[model samples]
Target: MKPSTSSFNEVKKAIVLLSGGLDSATVLAIATAQGYECHTMSFDYGQRHRSELDAAVRIAEQFHAKTHRVMQMNMNAIGGSALTDMDIAVPTGGLSETVPITYVPARNTVFLSYALALAEVVGALDIFIGVNAVDYSGYPDCRPEYIAAFETMANLATQAALEGHKVKIQTPLIHLSKAEIIQQGVALGVDYAKTVSCYQANSEGLACGQCDSCLLRKQGFREAGLDDPTPYAI
Candidate 1:
């Protein structure tokens, strides 16, 4: 018997920016479950924490992304952030009103630019990003206003938009707290152990446990009443 095909069979293409982090992993699961043929993208941007890229590749495969591309670019050249430059230290003091040292200058903009290009070429009108304002490192790019501005710019920049195909930038995890994101991902059967969100993960993929990223992740799992599966190099 043939499986019935209707609106349920209609799957749209989407470009997902996968960072191999907890939030991004959850975003991919959400996008896939929503019936998008997800094309995942990650950047090898000379970040100090390269282990996350390896995690990204694994998560993409696990989620059955239609395609996954890891692009090479040197953000180290334009470095102002701790993640890109070893000179600046990743803050462990805690989140503050000011953006932390780990905020890669224009990083999300650059990543979204690449995603927009891919979306245009692939005829995907939607791009999914896993940026969350809550329980985040306070990067300016993660704000909702920033994302809205980028979406406006993306629609204007694309020729497809001029031809009536409006591109939408989707941030499924935007307003959700870290605990909520983790809970949702767990419900979707996401293996938290497989995802790495540490600012400076070791070669073996163990988290530093002191960086802001690790602190936030640990806090989230604690708040969610879930055991943290991440290995830590204390």
Candidate 2:
């Protein structure tokens, strides 16, 4: 027997910002399991880590996203942050004051600008991003207020929103600790091996295990009592 037409029509579609990191991968799985036709979008923003992008591609393929678009937004022009700057060093130790060097200036702004464009083209009202405040890197854009402000901006900026179709920026992993995020993702059957969170992975994707990203990821997995799935020499 054929599936019901209503059933097919009822699938909620989402545009997910997948970065091939643990948080984003888990977000995609959650969206898929929740019945969203997830369309993933990643960017080659000239960051030090291409491994994360590669991992994103694998994660997108794992879910078989309706479509995956990797956009190239050049932020190499602005060398304000560590990820983009050769001079600055990625900080160690627990989360620090106001912001970290890894905090690219308006990184989320650049990313969300693209996500919004794609969402408009695809007519998807929901956008899933894996930005968290609990295990955050102190970027101002990672906060809930920032997201809310962006949502409001989206409502005003988009023609569809003006015409009554509103969009939602869903950060499911927001406000959750790294360990808690890991636990949730695992419970949701997210195979995190496909995700990469190292700030200093080599060309061959070997994680440095000392960068802030790697350290946090290690702590999270350890706290969760789960072995690290990333293929890194740590």
Candidate 3:
């Protein structure tokens, strides 16, 4: 959707972390709707689901982001997660109450660090991420506390913040349930079909319907009373 610019004399810039996933896509739509000129960033962090990188590009184009950048990093080198390590099988049985094997070590911290640097470079005081607490795998980093702590550190560590330009880490989907998130995205014209949330998506972006991510996505659509359009490999 076109960014709303009526309220501002000049459009404010914001950095959006796009993972080519449902949540991130929704976050992008929300950011645009709030009148930010979004600079979309995606990571090539050596994950098995490389197809999401391509999906990120498509989402960025559709959202008409001011700039789309894919940063390269080899998370596989330090891999403890199923996504970055091919040897580890993704758990398809169900979601776990504890942190799952899919939780990459300090992944969100690393991603946000890069995003923070990018924000400083681009003169953006806001960084948007799509981390959810409800209807999510129990990743510690996705919790509200973690985000709050990160934001606190960001303000202290950044030159911008020291200079009185405080940085705000935006988590629009953090408190929302999956169904609520989907409904909001729909209202903002986000095309959920284009997003790739599968933990084991094939090269063509067809999802393995059994993964935890797929399960949550399917349930989200069902709960929202919307038909899921994701292409599945099941």
Candidate 4:
């Protein structure tokens, strides 16, 4: 769903793909702090970890986003990952070198398509996505090469490009490790407590404390020398 652009102004506008996770929340805070009128988008893509949606709203509000939009998508129907398919149990094991089951098929592609459409609607030239390669979950879509390819495709696919207004896909967190991301967010006064990273958080938004996401988040906080503020369902 597209949000009202009533708050959009002369300041530069940026479309942020916010997943309500720690990285995305930090990206939103970073974009807003950089003086962009942030238009945040979150997806209700039929994932088992739907609790993150609520956290997205909270983070958006906290950063004073120009608009916060939640788009309902039926990725469950095309599920290939454990996140959208209930039959495939979420892995509690540690991260692996290969692509994990939690990597939703073409999720970032679909997400970026929506963001591109919204950017055209609101005249935004910049789109920010929180896809990190370092300390990532081994998702193919999280790589910097993938983001660059998508950006190139977006520029060619949109009418805005014909008019000489190129769309830039900005992955500010792409190279940063989780610890570095947390440090950046801390410097920007981001409230990490409101973010959720568990692959299967409960309805109350408590982390399972076992999934890959939760483990990564825990490690990040520990490495950053900060307390983990997430509530766990353990």
**Clash pairs for candidate 3:** none
lDDT of 2: 0.84
Off by over 4 Å in 3: 1-10
lDDT of 4 by residue, 5-28 (tens): 432334589999999999999999
Residue 72 CA error for candidate 3 (Å)? 0.5
Clashes of each: 0, 1, 0, 0
Deviation from native of the Cα of residue 186 in model 4, angstroms: 1.0
Over 137-202, each residue of candidate 1 has an lDDT whose tens digit, in order, gives 888999999999999999899777776778889999999999999999999989989999998898
Taking all chains together, each candidate's TM-score versus the true structure is 0.94, 0.92, 0.95, 0.95
Residue 5 C-alpha lDDT in model 2: 31
Q: Could you tell me which residue pairs clash in candidate 2? A: 20-56
The ten-residue window of minimal lDDT in model 4 covers 1-10
- Best lDDT among the predictions, by candidate number: 3
- The C-alpha RMSD of each candidate to the native structure, in angstroms, is 4.7, 4.3, 4.2, 2.8
Q: Which should have the higher lDDT, number 1 or number 2?
A: 1
Better of 2 and 4 by TM-score: 4
* RMSD to native, candidate 2: 4.3
Q: Residues 85-123, candidate 3: write the lDDT tens digits.
A: 999999999888788999999999999999988877777
Runs of candidate 2 with Cα error greater than 4 angstroms are 1-11
Error of 4 at 143 (Å): 0.8
lDDT-based ranking: 3, 4, 1, 2
